[model samples]
Target: MSADHAHALPAGVRPPTYHHFEDLAQQEESEKLGMWAFLITEVMFFGALFTAYTVYRNLYPEAFMDASSKLNWKLGAVNTLVLIVSSLTMALAIRAAQTGKYSQVIWQTVATMIFGATFLVVKYFEYMHKYHDGLMPGPTLFFTDVFGEHTPQARIFFSIYFAMTGLHAFHMVVGLGILTWVLIKARKRYFTPDRYLALENVGLYWHFVDLVWIFLFPMLYLLGAHYGLGH
Candidate 1:
């Protein structure tokens, strides 16, 4: 339904219902439920990738380890830390929205976006380094000596790496876009304590994105380190 507000609302009360929703409470419930449902689907999608990664890792343990080591764990670790802090800020922004503190929401959202941007920037540099090293998997890949007899399997590992991390980064970029919308609404004082479900939904998305990274950091960067298997 179009977001056109009901004909009547008390002064300063944001319109809380669309035509299909019985009241503000119903609207809030529906929106929150919708976000949860969407998140469940995302969980299943990533689960498939995790399953594939695990199967392949078992099949070619050494090649996976070797390919993983070519990655800069230090940079991955920093991005992980950055995203953790961004999750904190996202939570703070949601809290601020709940408390009707528009100023806090604005600043907190800005902090979240800054941290997210920092992550993408770090990732950009990492991608560039790979490009220069020819570690990126494709027709032009040149890391044969590094993996010795396991070059082809190592290539497969990098394919999974790029698919997983690249997808994760793409989600972060989308989250940033959502944050931008939330920031704009915040500046307009569009959300009040009673009508901030949009902000809450955005928080859900931001947290989910961060959670994916938390898993990814270990899966991609910590695998080789755990067994003392790679340089």
Candidate 2:
């Protein structure tokens, strides 16, 4: 390669060079490996929570089933669909970034954020319903009134419910922030066919968040659903 070509930024990539890597390919690989490592840690964190949930659930089977029945499955199902759609849009955004379709990248990223926000809004209503019904994690008269003798055991289920879903929601919020940043950079045309690591990395994170919710929905909302649980 010529001296000028070696020093010059790749076509469509803006200033602030990736200092640690010799070229775009190395940088991209490093970024991907870092993201995968972070995601693996996240998986372990969620796995521990799931293990605890399973243990408690098995120990208090009837109470857990009864508690699960109280959740609105319809809303959970709807949010699940919304998140899945967001993951699709995130993937599309990455594709657009790779193809240098800046306009499509912006639109797809915006769509993904909208879907993510929709999920949060639905989650808000769900939490509000639990609050009004006194189904929150702590002590409440509603549990006693509704579950009667099983109130203590029911609280344990709700505790795990809040911990898992609340953590997932927090990740969604973080993902939204990441997407917003990507949208801003994208508007500046800071990405190109050869250099769009930010978009790709954020896409992976968004998909990971969506995958967590996919598991959460089934575990928290659909367990023992055949036992006459209402939506």
Candidate 3:
């Protein structure tokens, strides 16, 4: 197609071609590769924390298990389901964008945002409970009293818990902002079936965040549940 014709195409119907790309497909491929590379960096970022947790957990298995029991698994499980549902909605939004269903895209994006907000609300309560119980990462009174013989080790477990979950929560907050932006753009019909690269990339990010929680829930909350390590 001529440059003028490509430029005149309705929003979302045709992908935009970048200066370096010979065609829209090439541009899209380049964008996808860039996003994947960024996600790889994100993986390494979280992987480091996972490594630290593994080393510490091994060093103090009993203390770690004991600290794990203090967390509210029921709430963690609920949040897991919420995030999973949000991921589903995000996927649906991307599909809608791909199909040129702008209305569906808006609704699905809004739904995903709602689910994400709900997850954060639940997380707020969980954190508040921890604060009230004096479970803030240091050698606090609750930590000392609850894990008298294992205070030092248990403190390490709580530290990891807060660090991991806090980082995850921060990502959720970022996802919320992304979804909100997507919602606004969808309302303006910014995405079209052939050119919803933004939606696709954001969906990939939301999915990655959700996937992280999947591993986190099992590791931080359910690992030793059968051994009475869950509250």
**Which candidate number has the best TM-score?**
3
Give the lowest summed-lDDT range of ten residues in model 1: 1-10
- Itemize residue pairs with steric clashes in candidate 2: none
TM accuracy, model 1: 0.90
lDDT of 2 by residue, 81-185 (tens): 999999999999888877777778899999999999999999999999998898886656344567767778888888899999999999999999988899898
Model 1 Cα lDDT, one tens digit per residue, 45-122: 999999999999999998888888888889999999999999999998888767767678899999999999999999
What are the models' TM-scores? 0.90, 0.89, 0.91
In angstroms, the error of model 3 at 20 is: 1.5
The weakest ten consecutive residues by lDDT in model 2 span: 1-10
| Model 3, span 1-231: residue lDDT tens | 123333544645665577888988888888888999999999999999999999999999888888888889999999999999999999988888766677788999999999999999999999889888888865453445678888778888888899999999999999998888888888887877667888899999999999899989988987558877447
Q: By how many angstroms RMSD does model 1 differ from the true structure? A: 5.2
Between prediction 1 and prediction 2, the one with superior lDDT is 2
Which residue ranges in model 3 land beyond 4 Å of their true spot?
1-13, 138-143
**RMSD, every candidate, angstroms:** 5.2, 4.6, 4.1
lDDT of 1: 0.85
